[model samples]
Target: MTSSVRGAQLARLLGQWHALPGRHRRPDYAALAAAVRGLLSDGRLPLGVRLPAERELAEALGISRTTVSAAYRALRETAHLTSRRGAGSWTTLPQGHRVATSGLWAAGDDGDVIDLGVAASPAPDELIGAARAAADDLPRYLGSAGYHPTGLVELREAVADDYTARGVATSAEQILITAGTQQALDLVLRLSVPAGAPVLVESPTYPNALAALSARRARISTHGLDAATGWDGELLLGALRQGRPRVAYVIPEFQNPTGHLMDAALRERLVATAHTAGTELIVDESFVDLSLDGAEMPPPVAVFDRHSRVVSIGGMSKAYWGGLRIGWVRASAPLVQRLAAIRVGVDMASPVLEQLVAVRLLAQAPQIVAARRAQLRGRRDALLGALRDHLPEWTVTVPAGGVMLWAELDGPISSALSRAAEDVGVRLAPGPRFGLDGTLERFLRLPFALDEETLTEAVKRIASVRYDLDRGARPTWRAPAVIA
Candidate 1:
């Protein structure tokens, strides 16, 4: 790629590097430094990968080498890197380069390279003011023990109200707030799923959900979503009905990575199928609000949960901000009570500050929605255009809305593609990250939450890296599991 082309691409990618927690500060220099620190801390950028030369990386990031050098120097002085004359500076692990890894909360991480791992975006600028003002409204809970096991009444009420706003009839008694959606899902699975019981999930579902269920030793089964035709609602419903699964967890709204939204009719029928099969429908609506193209809203799975068989999980992570550490579960009152009992034994409750912030943030829902939609829109267009230009051999389906995107690599270059990305300065979530059986080997998920310029650069780098990977040697890729 030419410098001008790379520079333009880098500009698009780096533009989306908004000021995140401990990442970007006011001055671009400070921001890049903190970003480097974040990469190292996140382990997306490992200590020693022999980063791309200063000029290449600089062009890829659309910045001057001086800034990159200063950032590297700062990290090196902090023992985050080691440099020797004639040899490029190699980032060193914090405690021991051999094994010890820095925690994500640590201050220095930018020294490492390749950070295509995080699937998050910075909070809207409006959140800071909202959060500051919301603190003043928190005095009422200060006198109490601050041990809200189910969550603050206001936040729970807000969540229920939001459900109602989404065309679902919900009440505060039906809701319980935890520390974001992950915990909420964890709580429900912990309380409901039994050992060795059949757990049905969409193939290429969120990986963490599989982990949680697996830790419980559940007999996990999958209903594969066809990329060519999107999802097969009838087949999935048939499987659920025929097998009578114990639990069916799904991301119906803008389903993760694939970004395919299940139609409303499908959701209704699936809910009925679960009810008939005596299965609990665990519906995750985490990405419901990420409509990048102003597309029609996909109805929440909870909307069809009238039979009381559906359990709902919503969070502030994907929809709002990940750092908030707040999410909630809406189910029957009895089920909520059960999870609450299970939760106290796990971790008391989500922090009061976060709950307070969530409540405050809920008040500005319109603003958050608008900002997120706008950012995603720009990111989607940029990524689509870049892929079309540079990686013409690859295949990409522009999703209507979602933080992450599911794309095919023309061929089964999933593993090779990942290695190629690592060769440059990108760490991508492989298609297998979305599934357990490794059927997603031909696919890749990219989060467009980054800026347009950064998205372009990331794609260009991946393309260049792929070309490099294909040249001399052909590595045997993992054989994706054959669909039965």
Candidate 2:
């Protein structure tokens, strides 16, 4: 038996069911069953969510109990719902359904397997030196309880100073340390947006962010971000005016996967728009430091925030080593305090040694950034060249800065291609993982964080897989859309 939802809750989740297309042409029970199927297929109704009892749901929807029973029976026939005598019905994917996984792909134990799924780089040698320095400096905190829920004072000040240098004046009091940008995003979304309230996001935004928002059950509103033109300002502004979402999450600088940087003028306009609509803006600047063009980057969007409506999240995972696991949230002091209090209920505090190492790493930002840019530039060039030489049919945009290339395939078969690649010891994240409604199937995010030899081999394997797929080879099994 799956977890059950109350009749009122199920009714709320099925908002505007009657407005679905073709309702007038079908019977009441069939239309209702079709609506449920659409919700399950599109991920609006998550797997294992027990539906309301027939009589209770009938009362809530103002329908006869027989209609509700018939609808449930219809769903049972389709295998979208399963129920036991005592246990109520729950939603599920039909057998043989192929959907994109909602999170990062896991690496298999095979050493020869190439993981193009995750965009992460190896730690620099400086990490060892910083760890040693942090170990030497760890004695100072030994006298205390060592559980600083907010963060170490020195690390907070360092983060503030870094932001200050970037033209956003920040203070230690306004910063809350998190495990990483993922946790920072999770905390901000949970604390700021109410369940069922509208929340705006970029359509082809980060996958993990979508997962976080979906987990919160926030009413998501999306505006498209073109790979060529970056964000559509008019579309976003219109959504702000009409949707009036409680929170707007954006990756303004060096956006993930797309690698398009949001201009400073557009940033100001977005901040102004969000402010006018009374919606708080959450700016994720995790990719800000990875610019490969050597051009002067714009200041954070928080610089344009006068109404305290912008909350910025910065992290070390992209620019520096992900092993440090240090990220921070910059907001008003009161909001910082609230997030910190919430943090206590989660993990209490981040690792003190990691905080200390992050403090040292902050002081070495210049050197670390230079080295990262050089390595990433080389890898990016190599991958682009290999793709041009091997898979010329795929169109790719060279991101000015960032770890991945968003490539458009010849057809909407990214899921099928990924499944085929897995058979050849290559893993990929299909395009639908980054969008709603199972869209963007023609795109794939290819990471350039690996060595040239590894990347070349991976692309060669992918090409081979594509060949097999084109020749009518079928995948034996399907990857689950939601991984454990």
Candidate 3:
């Protein structure tokens, strides 16, 4: 089951390959090789995916075949690519090279390193008491076989009740708990999206969702997002009607990276358009509970779904803690059954103790979320101030909620910035990682989930890296202690 990228697609992913930061205007084979290597390191170009042929890529990129050949040859020599005579070339990692796809490894291995790759924070203080309560509650279920694919009843009721409080009347039967939002998305995609089906997503949506769509071989359609303002209503409606995708994944509330919240009017129109297009909606509400601006939150998109066409996915990772590993999907009861049936074949059920902890956490969510928001507000401001002090040239959009800030750099050097930042003990989530086809190179997503002091230090290091990169000096690369 080898996935082969088309020449046009590869060209799109290699957007502005010639005009990389500190590189000359004229594209050389060395620059091309470096670009591909950067893609591989950042998990953009997954290993083992067959690359387009040199001639085909050359035609698509409007370059000579000789340059493409030399680039491919350089990649092959570095063990970043493998080739057979007729089967074509495929991407691969070098034998001893270790790339931290998630920044946790680098942070754990090096104390000085700051991981801005993930936008999650540590657990709230309420979690410790909840864990103790969960421990006490766990023994009651020990005698049974312990298999609840639709999730534990108490937790489901809690989630459904939370939705109900948010204006969507949800029943316990409509909830299916999974490991996290990622797992819930996977379950929904597994049951809903078929191979080669058209799937609409936001241009700079969640990168992992894009990876899942790619793995499913879905035909992806994207509508661009404005970080300052949310979605353009007319553009999105037009895309829905034209694309007519089988499924559309959207993050209406405090969207990841870009924290723009969707207004209720847009929600109604978008859901109406989806119904007219006969497309199902997968609404991600992972950041729903993290409103920092004190604005009254808009109603969940499900409020506009008259036909149960919208499936809402949420989790405890962002507002609660990533360690909880608790997330659930809110859909029609029948759809929940189908998703649960599919999920049973995959992982049976979420761990009971964790679900118990989530139930307790939900009961105390009000206090936890308020404190979390206050903490995040300070961190967000601190990060903003640091950015202003360290790098005044970059433009940043102030998000109403969510844990990360979307920034526009002065140049299309996000990938280069990431490469250089590693030397300064900082791991960054570059702009292109959130985009499709190597787009958004002029942007970056800086998470404010860390403490104010840490955020200040990370911004300082990043500013230093940016300075070195702008001066056309490459930072000295040092190997991280951890290989995994």
Best by lDDT: 3
- Residue-level lDDT of model 1, residues 246-360, one tens digit each, is 9999988778768888888888898888888999999898887787777778667777776789998988887688888888898999989999999999998778877888888
Clashes of 1: 16
Q: Rank the candidates by TM-score, best first.
A: 3, 2, 1
After superposition, the stretches of candidate 3 with alpha carbons farther than 4 Å from their true spots are 1-7, 25-27, 50-56, 76-79, 82-90, 102-110, 474-484
**Residue-level error in angstroms, candidate 1, position 350:** 1.4
Off by over 4 Å in 1: 1-114, 473-484
TM-scores vs. true structure, each candidate? 0.76, 0.81, 0.93
Write one digit per residue (lDDT tens) for candidate 2, span 1-484: 4567777766765555564334455678986786566445334457888888899999988889999999999888767789889877888655645333321122332466687878889998799999999999999999988899889989999999988998988999999999999999999988987788799999798988988988899989898989777898888889998888999999978787788888888898999999999999999988888989888898789999999999999899999988788999999999999999889999999999999999988899999999999999999999999899889999987899989999999876666577567667787887766776566768899989999999998999988888775565523433434434
Which TM-score value belongs to model 1?
0.76
- Model 3: per-residue lDDT, tens digit, 230-262? 799999999999989999999998887788899
Q: After superposition, how far is residue 153 of candidate 2 from its true place, in Å?
A: 0.7
lDDT of each: 0.73, 0.82, 0.88
Q: Give model 3's TM-score versus the native structure.
A: 0.93
RMSD of each: 14.7, 7.1, 2.6
